[model samples]
Target: MDSFTLNKAAGAVLMVLILTMGVGIVSDIIFEPTIPGEPGYEIVLATPEDSTSEVEPEPDVVPIGERLMAASASAGENVAKKCAACHSFDQGGGNKVGPALWNVMGRKPGGLDGFGYSSAMTAYGEEKPEWTYEGMDNFLAAPKQYISGTSMGFAGLRRPEERADMIAYLRELSENPMPLPGQ
Candidate 1:
């Protein structure tokens, strides 16, 4: 072949190789398995099912608010631990660093006796009669946002389901536990 024809052939081959490698690299990056909690990624793997014995499925247990205190499910209890630093759930367990949370789920904000609350909580108390589920949900989602200047230093629970579970757990501690299932 002439020099110019040979050079053109070599350049075409190089271009094809570069394009092929670029596509392969892109595919690898896009298709690689990702581990869970990794930024912008998720991990998924399937394990083979056991073939020896046919195990019976456990009965579905709904977590009622009253039963949450005694039930084995740990979601609500797990979330409740976050409040232990400043609040107490046990009956007659007076205010700690924060007000006693024993029955605060339904009681009015800043209404508990002997507990000195900030102006924010007292202000919320003025307009809000009692802490219902919706009220508690809003408060727990963003404590400071709900009542600015509140003494509660907690940043607040960001997860809706987690807040719900914690509220359900708190309700279980009341003298009259509110009814809730699958909390």
Candidate 2:
């Protein structure tokens, strides 16, 4: 209310504003990239002496059948949590975002009567008669990549063992479990 008080408050506000601007300016000066094009470091990749030699990548994972032979249904149940949001594993379970996967191992892809499937999935089913072990492996590895234009947004299981376990769990979901790879 007094002139002196008002003047002091105004001066304090101005000082704070100026101090904030000063810190911002100093940080910009210190952190800004010094040179435009220079990465400031070099990445050197080693090359083979014989350029003509073709290199084949060694496979890191064994076949799904081999993995399935040792797969664990209990672990598979845990992995199924990822799919639980979209599919129902119980027999007579209703479809969710994706169809109910109850007894899906031997069933045709996109074959669930009530659930709608993407065109890509329907066509993939036409070409591939049933969800064989290997087919399940490939599809579970990369659904979108395995069947282009598929609507499944799942990133697919990356571990071979996990896929096998998931397949094993799915196998048991059926009233009549399909034979295992060796069985």
Candidate 3:
């Protein structure tokens, strides 16, 4: 309110600021921090060219047909459960997110009439014609990779046995399941 009171308050504020600065300076001198030349831990990544360790060769890939011989439709039915969310395995089940997979084996890719197919899948169908054991196998392994622009969101079955089982189960969905490969 008055000049004396205002000056005192201003002087108190200035004194507090000076005290804080002085403490910081004195603390810095007393406890000096040693800065490292390199900040954090150095991460050494091994590139193929620089790597000296021997890389193991990939395992021998058994043919899909041979894998199918040992595959069980029951196990495949379980795997197909995931497919059930997108596709209907039963005959006349109709399309869900994906076209009904009833009798998908030997059927043309993008063959389902009612459901819309991706241009990539239509193009793939044009290229491949029908879904052969090998074609289906590859498609089941990686849908997007098999058909680059396909709308299929499924990541696909990574395990060959699981794919074979799924194919086996799908085969059974029809009136006459296609003869298993090598049968």
Candidate 4:
């Protein structure tokens, strides 16, 4: 309307436009769109044009079973400490609150003689076949989950390494040693 009012409004609009442009430029400079899966963004650095050598990494060679056993033995010692109250691996090992875990690797789910297995274990035994390495591994990882209604009160081992080592130690109790992975 008036010259003074129109001049002030125009100056305010110009100031706002300048501030917006300045903020946009600063934002563009500060943040890079290099995150993977985000579109229209890439990250690259300049290098010497003559550099042509490629370095290949050595492939992993250990079998899955061996790796699990190694991880188990290392983690098993610590985890088995929790099982020491009712179980023993030394001579004259007897079932306590739980069955003595000798040769449990390939044995049936509830095969221990003279020990009264819980209904859950019995059911699991009826439903499942002999405990292979993978079977035991899965069972130990989650006993209640594996059997659904077993009476073993102990919580299962959650870590892969602990299950591997515990199985390794149990296999050691047998006259024949269990072979490592890929066998």
Please give the lDDT score at residue 158 for candidate 4: 64
At residue 19, candidate 1 shows an lDDT of 100
lDDT for each residue of candidate 4 in 1-183, tens digit (9 for 90 to 100): 899999999999999999999999999899865666766757875453633222121144333376464564545666778888977665457888888776666667788887899876876677666676666766676666665656766787766656777777776766665665576
Q: After superposition, how far is residue 162 of candidate 2 from its true place, in Å?
A: 0.9
lDDT of 3 at 15: 100
| lDDT score for candidate 4 against the true structure | 0.68
Clashing pairs in 2: none
The prediction achieving the highest lDDT against the true structure is 2
Error of 3 at 49 (Å): 26
66-86 per-residue lDDT for model 3 (tens digits): 888888999999998898888
Cα TM-score of candidate 3: 0.69
In order of listing, the candidates' clash counts read 0, 0, 0, 5
lDDT tens per residue, model 2, 1-183: 999999999999999999999999999999995775866688875443433212221288787778888999889999999999998988799999999998999999888899899998898788877888888888888887677678999998988889889988988888888887777
Runs in model 2 lying further than 4 Å from the true structure: 1-58
For 79-111, candidate 1 gives per-residue lDDT tens digits of: 888888888878899789998888776688799
- What TM-score do all the candidates reach, one by one? 0.57, 0.68, 0.69, 0.57
**Whole-structure CA lDDT of model 2:** 0.84
Over 4 Å off, model 1: 1-73, 179-183
